[model samples]
Target chain A: MAHLASFSFTSSPSNSASSLSPLLQSHQQPHLSSPLQDTLINIDNSATMTNSYKYSVLLPTYNERENLPVIVWLLTKTFQENNINYEIIVIDDNSPDGTLVVAEQLQKIYGEDRILLRPRAGKLGLGTAYVHGIQHATGDFIFIMDADMSHHPKFMPEMIRLQQAKNLDVVTGTRYAGNGGVYGWDLRRKVISRGANFLASVLLRPGVSDLTGSFRLYRKEVLSRLIESCISKGYVFQMEMMVRARQFNFTIGEVPITFVDRVFGDSKMGAMEIVSYAQGLWKLFVAV
Target chain B: MTRATEAATAIGILGTIYLALLFQWLPITLPPTIQEFILPVLPWWVLVTFGAYSLGNIGYHVMTFRDCPEAYDELQVQISQAQNDLRSKGIGL
Candidate 1:
């Protein structure tokens, strides 16, 4: 488990689970032994593994309580199968639906070292959530993905493999690429996403097929530099990151991914998001 | 080197050779700095390897996909188990 003092919890859990799991209840007791030594050597590499690069999954959650456990389990299974050293930094923005409680349960199951819960006051923007998560991540490669279960962990190994094989600075999951597509989205959403990507490509010339994809693996330093260079605050942040990466001359790779719509809870995207994306794209074209 | 890297390297070398030979005989307005500084530094293989890689990909898929089993079937099972586990706890679908 990572040192408790090492984390910076910006805000406390506003609400707790009304009923605790037996494991959590057991944990509530004074003290207990660790989970059967975990037997897995990769778990030992949670904090900056010595030999190989460790991947830090930055899962920014907001009202993702329902989707959290399934995603975490899927992540655990994926990483375990691939034998990758990793940690999950869940940067939650004070979700009211007991999301933090689910996250805490996840931390217990996976060990505190693997799951870092960094909560904040309220619903901050997506970019700031990433900024907060990066501050606490200890991995050499940082993974940014949604906690809403839209982006499955199945494609992660491919992303990592492509990143390694190509010596890539960035490997983003693209739904528009070969063998990649969106599932469960209506015609309107499909059109919007495609139109947005087309416009961004035409204007920015980033050479990346998908500019709005958030599921990406980044070299920690490259991401830090991009974050510093990027000025987009909200929906435009993902596109801005790609644009800045191109201007700064970073090589980005692509892994085709089937992006599924959220299985539970509502998608936060709406007309406002589209309008802001257009505005942000215009700003990026003019500035960058 | 892996197949992809080998492919990339072979294509890169071929493209470089082709460009050099073509430019030697053909009169093109290409800047000298491109041959000296930029082309050498750029990861042209990323673009150059596309022809071989995508062709291989298309051929392989077209020939094999009809008879090939679903490669990610096991992955689908694992995902179903995970979803069911969540469903048991009434957590997620």
Candidate 2:
């Protein structure tokens, strides 16, 4: 945690008639040799205005130590090239592999103001991590992506420009829409992905093309409201957010991008997740 | 008096009648000749068992109609309270 030092100044005019007349005379004169002028000059010189639209990237990690440095480097390079004012908030769930240690090192390399390490005790759910990260974010827009290199930082500039051009409330990357494709998945995996999406669309009728994709950019308040309205956790959480976005009447813009499997570590998808996805779809179908 | 409630009540009554018919058709302690003769014709036990089971089923329907909806509403309230508590503590389900 970074310590913030705040300095406050208070001024009160004296009630003495002589002091009051001098104060009034100083105000009347355009240039006066008074302490008030010195203080005002000091304040004007000391305060510096910062740029607007600081982007906060919320990255939730569990055991992503090896991938942390590389992702941060990519993000830095991309932001520097585009001249985007940004900060990366790493929300680690206290991985046993010392992911926080790496994040701290990155903070030292890039100033603490640019990189923030917000860690929790143990493995909490993904939805909670985003909520926690957003609380500390100072940006007007929040970007969420995986730290496993599955989501590239190169697409960020285009996403921002496209969002500005269209004035969209949310911009999402879709793998199943128009020229976007998935690679490195076997026939069974592809079939399961397509079938699950089809089942959700048939039941919920969410307007988004890819309901299960997680790479998204949202206006900070829009994401907060959508997260509050959503009910599903884990893999189904992403689907629920999109469905709720449609429910609340938010404009959504989709950008086609290829989704590649993670380059490092193991995939988190399992049989239980598939079963839970089906059950969550049924629940949303009835509730929403 | 809704269609769903009436259908549920009808199904409950039919299930009770089926159970009574099965119990009467299969007597536990009957002489072989008497059982054979009675089983072949309309048995006296069938009517009595049907009467008891149908009455029991009708009692269940009346009890459910009186209390089931309120119980369901209470369960929903409990679930909502639990969700709000989790959210306040920064825990997401």
The number of the candidate with the highest lDDT is 1
The top-ranked prediction according to TM-score is 1
Per-candidate fnat, comma-separated: 0.08, 0.00
- Model 1 lDDT per residue over A1-288, tens place: 333311211122111111112223343453543442221122222311332779999998888887788788989888887688889999888888879988887776678999999999999888778888889999999999988766879788667756764578999987776667665666556656666766676567789887888999999999989998888977689988988888788989888776766667777788888898888887787778
In terms of lDDT, the poorest run of 10 residues in model 1 chain B is B62-71
Residues A82-180, candidate 2: write the lDDT tens digits: 678899999999999888987887787788999999999898889999999999999989999999766667667656655664567888988776546
> Which stretches of model 1 miss by more than 4 angstroms?
A1-51, B1-80, B83-93
Candidate 2 TM-score over all chains jointly: 0.62
lDDT, candidate 2, residue A265?
90
| Candidate 2 chain B lowest-lDDT run of ten | B61-70
Could you tell me the fnat of model 1?
A: 0.08
Q: Write the residue-wise lDDT of candidate 2 on B1-93 in tens digits.
A: 322354468679976755555456544556776555655454357678866765554444233221123333433454355345434543333
